[model samples]
Target: MDTASLKKEIIAYSKTIGIDKIGFASPSTFEEMKVRLYRQQELRYQSGFEEKDIEKRTEPSLIFDKPKSIISIALAYPSKMGPKVISKKGERRGIFSRASWGTDYHTVLRDRLKKLEEYIALKMPEARFKSMVDTGELVDRAVAERAGIGWSGKNCSIITPEFGSYVYLGEMITNIPFEPDHPMEDRCGSCNKCVDVCPTGALVQGGQLNAQKCIAFVTQTKGFLAEEFREKLGNRLYGCDTCQTVCPENKGKDFHFHTEMEPNPEIAKPLLKPLLSISNREFKEKFGHVSGSWRGKKPIQRNAIIALAHYRDETAIPELITVMKDDPRPVLRGTAAWALGKIGGQDALEALQHAFSVEKDEEVLQEIRKGLYFFAEKKQG
Candidate 1:
């Protein structure tokens, strides 16, 4: 088995599989990353992650055994794709963040990487290797930078010259002695577009990010949002792409290329009315393939209400009033009340008053009364 010949074939195979970039690095390149993970854990940034993530990420053996090289792969995520017509009365711009505009990358990349592994094994039957995506222990973005896949931007996302920061990263750890690639130079010089445009103030100075305050992370988080952060959520139902959209690297890029990944017309830009009234089974059938569907229908439905409230879309008020009374999830009921307040109309106010009278939970009833007060006050003024 000629190891050199196999290495060359692997790279060629990866490109053929649709990966935009591939590079190599020594496993030792991630020493600093292990330390930073500990610091982030102490600071409570990774509270949701199990302790195993912290432990395994630091294990040199876990990523590779007697490893001599690392391979990092990048897949270009189409950042723009949506409808052409805009309604003058209600334009809910149902744009997909570059990452979501295609079939989910997890399956696509995994299938490719697994094939690459099989190729390597055939060439060197005794070789050792493992592959992983975003779900892995080792910080994918950090390894990506070391492998020269791209530079870590101020937004803390991996950015390539061709794909900007709108790309997904995956990796393979192997014991083969392949030559590592050079890293990309930092091109984000004097650029603060991503930070300046953030609605949640999650990005700090020097390119550090606090995920707790990130709108993307918050939207995906389970349970209800705090009162203070509710209104700031705006009309974002799933993930927030505000920071990435404003990036200079992503700006002016052509969108006419490939954008077939946009959601179904009705599903892509969901109607507030239907979202507020759907059964759990219907929600699953519609959004099951998308990232937003993972946390189940409750959080998204809750976010839809929040977004409706922020947009002040009074047209959705009738449905909002309906959900306010019958939503199985208390969180959804609470958020619907808030939306009714924001979209105050005579019918919405009356619904809130009725809810307040029947509401048993103090916290939920408080939210209902809050909505009623605002609706009544708006009518008076």
Candidate 2:
């Protein structure tokens, strides 16, 4: 089999199926990445969502027997959304970060990878392969960097020249010995824009990230947001985009190549108040198709409550009261109490005091105390 010819054919086919960029890489151990990951682990900077085993994450041979190469693919998603949906006055909207703007990218990229896998299988029936997207053990950014898909940006994202940082990345491991492509150069030198703009200072120095402090990672947590980051979260419902939006490379790089990847403005930037009371069925039906909804409704609803406080939306005081007084989940009830305190008013104070009389959970009681403290400080000032 002419491996070169097969590689050429695969590249051609990938473009036809909506893959924005494709590259081949050797299945060598990611030594540098393993070291960096070890350091991150030592510092307790990991998001706890990644694979725990470092060997399986960095060593290709551990995953696939004598794996020869990895194929990396990038699919561009829309960054510049369509027309804004106007929310009525006294109503505020919460934003889902750009990565979650469209259909769940896991489905989109996995579909393309499956197609590629089939194409390869037809050429060599005995060839073994393994595929992965974000949830997989192998780091997609590391694979993309080695495969020439893009350069690893200061924001810790793969920044392709053509699509910028607004691209979804996925990869496949194979036993085929395809020629490897050259890695991209570090073009982010001297530009501290991404690091400078991180809302929570999560970007340490320039390249490394403290995921525990990152707004993007924090927004996905099921518990109450840390006190410091609650205000930093702004109106983000699922993720944070300050670092990416500030990246000069991502500027003017919006691409609406796939129709399915288009953002419905209403879902991407939904009204904040209504979200606090949305039923499980209603939330699923409206947001089930989007990528950000993968963590389910809890985190999104939690962040929505935090966002209402950020806006100090007086109109949302009643809804916050309902969540604080009646929501079954302690995280929701506690977070609502906190938000009520942040968006201080006579009604917010009254709700917190009432909940204090009947709230059962100890953790929730602590939050209620914090809420009332905000009221006390306000009155004294």
Candidate 3:
């Protein structure tokens, strides 16, 4: 079997199955990445979501037996929503980042990888393969960079020449000796736009991120948002796209190649007040198909309350009061209390004062105090 011919066939087959870009890489130990992983660990900069084993993450051989090459694939998602849902006064909305605009990308990428695997298996019956999306042990960006998919951008995303940094990456490890593609040059050069625009200053430096400070990571946390980052969240409900949106490389880079990748404006940018009262079943029914819903409604709802605060929407005050007074989750209740304080008015202050007197939870009481402080500040001013 001619390995070179087989690689060419796989590339051609990939295009037919909706893979936007494909590249092959040698399955060598990612020595440089291993160093960075250790540094991230030492600095406590890692998001708890990543696979814990650094060896498995960097050494393909540790996860897949006799791996000869890694096939990196990228699928571009839309940067712009088709029919914009205007977030006007009295009807403010929260936004999921562009990455969560469509059907869960994990499902889309996994389907594409499975098809590629099936095609390769049929051609070479003995080829052993292992594949993974974002949740997998292998770092998708590192694999893509090595496979010539793109360069690792300043914002810690794979910036493909064709799709900028708005691409979803997946990889397959196999015992096939395909010729490796060369990695792309660091086109980011002196551009620090992504770092400059990161709301939380999550981009510690070029190609490095302190995930704890990233609004994208913070939005997914199922807890009371820290007071410092609350205002920075703006109306983002799930992830933060400030870094990508500010990237000059991503300028004019929007693609609608796959129907599944399209955003439903209503779901992607839904009314914030409606989100405050949404039932579990209602939340699941509407947002379950999107990747942003994976953390479930708790984080999204918490962020929604903060978004309401960001807009200082007087109309959402009633819903925020209800959440503050009756929500089962302490995080939501506390977040609602804070939102009430931020969206201060006579009614909002009255509700916070009432909650402070009756709320049993210690954390909730503290939030209620924080809420009342806004009124105190207003009086002093």
Candidate 4:
């Protein structure tokens, strides 16, 4: 069997199937990454969204037998919003991170992998294969770095020379012993732009990240946001793009090659007030197609309230009061209370006082008191 010739064939076929970039690497144990993972765990910096099993995450051989090589793939997504984006005066909008702007990359990449796997299976009938996108046990960035897809930028994103950091990564672990490609050099020397621009200082030193402090990680959490992060969140509904947006490598890099990845302006930069009142079914119908909707509407709605507060949107007060008083979830009610305080006025003050009297939940009551304290502090000033 001419394995090298087969590799050439696969690469050619990958281009036909809309894969932006492809690279091959040996599937050895990721020794260095294991150390970093353990350190992140020791510092209690993990987002709790990652796979808990460190051994399974770093060792590809455990996932698939005789895993000789890994084939990493990348798809470029558009970084900028579409032309028809609405920017109104009274009603402000919240931005979803660039990754979540398009149709879910997982679905798109999975389809591409299925095609690659099928093509390889026909060529080598006995070759076993396993593929994963961002959700898989193997760290996508680690695999990408080893596979010569891109260098790991200081922002913790894989910076492809052609696509910058605006690319979706996925990989295939195969039993084929294809020759490995050379990894890209770390080109982010002395550049602290991503680190300095990060809203929550999630970037620790150069490459390490405290996931707990990252606005991207914070946006996905299903509980109450810490007070410090609330103001830092700005108007983001899901994920944070400050690091990538600030990267010099990412400058003038916006690709609209894949049709599935085009952003719907309304969904990507949605009105803050309308999000607070969206029903469960309505949330799904509108935002279920986007990647940011994975945690469902609760976190997004909570963040929307915070975004409205960040904007000091007096127009959103009615919706905020409705959520504060009538919402079933204590997290929402509590967040709404905090936002009302931040966006304070006489009605906001009255609402906080009224809620303080009847709100039974300790957390919500605490938030109401905090809301009223805003006025007290204002009066003193």
Best by TM-score: 3
- Candidate 1 — worst ten consecutive residues by lDDT sum? 87-96
Pairs of colliding residues, candidate 4: none
What ordering of candidates by TM-score runs from best to worst?
3, 4, 2, 1
Per-residue alpha-carbon lDDT of model 3 for 1-381, expressed as tens digits?
789999999999999999999999999999999999999999999999999999999999999889999999999999988887798999998899988987999999999999999999999999999999999999999999999999999999999999999999999999999999999999999999999888888899998999999998999899888888997888899998888998999999999999998999999999988888899999999999999999999999999889889988999899999999999889999989988898899899889988988989999898988889888988899
| Cα error, candidate 2, residue 365 (Å) | 1.8
Candidate 4, residues 1-381: lDDT per residue as tens digits? 788999999999999999999999889999999999999999998989989988989999888888999999999999887676664667799989998987988999999999999999999998999999988989999999998999999999999999999999999999899999999999998999998878788898789999999999999999988889997999899999899988999999999999999998899998888889899999999999999999999999999999888888888888899999999999999999998998899889888889998999999998888888888898999
Q: What's the lDDT of the predicted structure labeled candidate 2?
A: 0.92
lDDT of each: 0.73, 0.92, 0.93, 0.91
Error of 4 at 266 (Å): 0.6
What ranking of all candidate models by lDDT puts the best one first?
3, 2, 4, 1
Q: Find the 10 residues in a row with the least total lDDT in model 4.
A: 81-90
Cα distance off (Å), candidate 2, residue 255: 0.1
For candidate 2, what is the TM-score?
A: 0.97
Off by over 4 Å in 4: none
Judged by lDDT relative to the true structure, which candidate is superior, 1 or 4? 4
Q: Tens-digit lDDT track for model 2 on 1-381? A: 689999999999999899999999999999999999999999999999999999999998998999999999999988888888875557789999888887889999999999999999999898899999989999999999999999999999999999999999999999999999999998998999989878888999777999999988999999877789887888889888888889999889889999888889999999998888899999999999998998899999999998888888889988899999888999999999999999899898988999999999999999999999999999899
Task: Name the better of 1 and 2 by TM-score.
Answer: 2
Q: Which stretches of candidate 3 lie over 4 Å from their true place?
A: none
lDDT of 1 by residue, 1-381 (tens): 565677688888877766678888767746666777777667766636434566567564665668777788877755544554442235343322445544566776787688878877887887787888877766788779989999989888988888788777888888888877787899999988888878878886536777788777787776779876686777667777888888888875533332334445455556655677778789878777665676787777788788777777877787788788887677888878977887788888788888988988776787887787786787699
Tell me the TM-score of model 1.
0.91
Pairs that clash in candidate 1: 78-98, 79-98
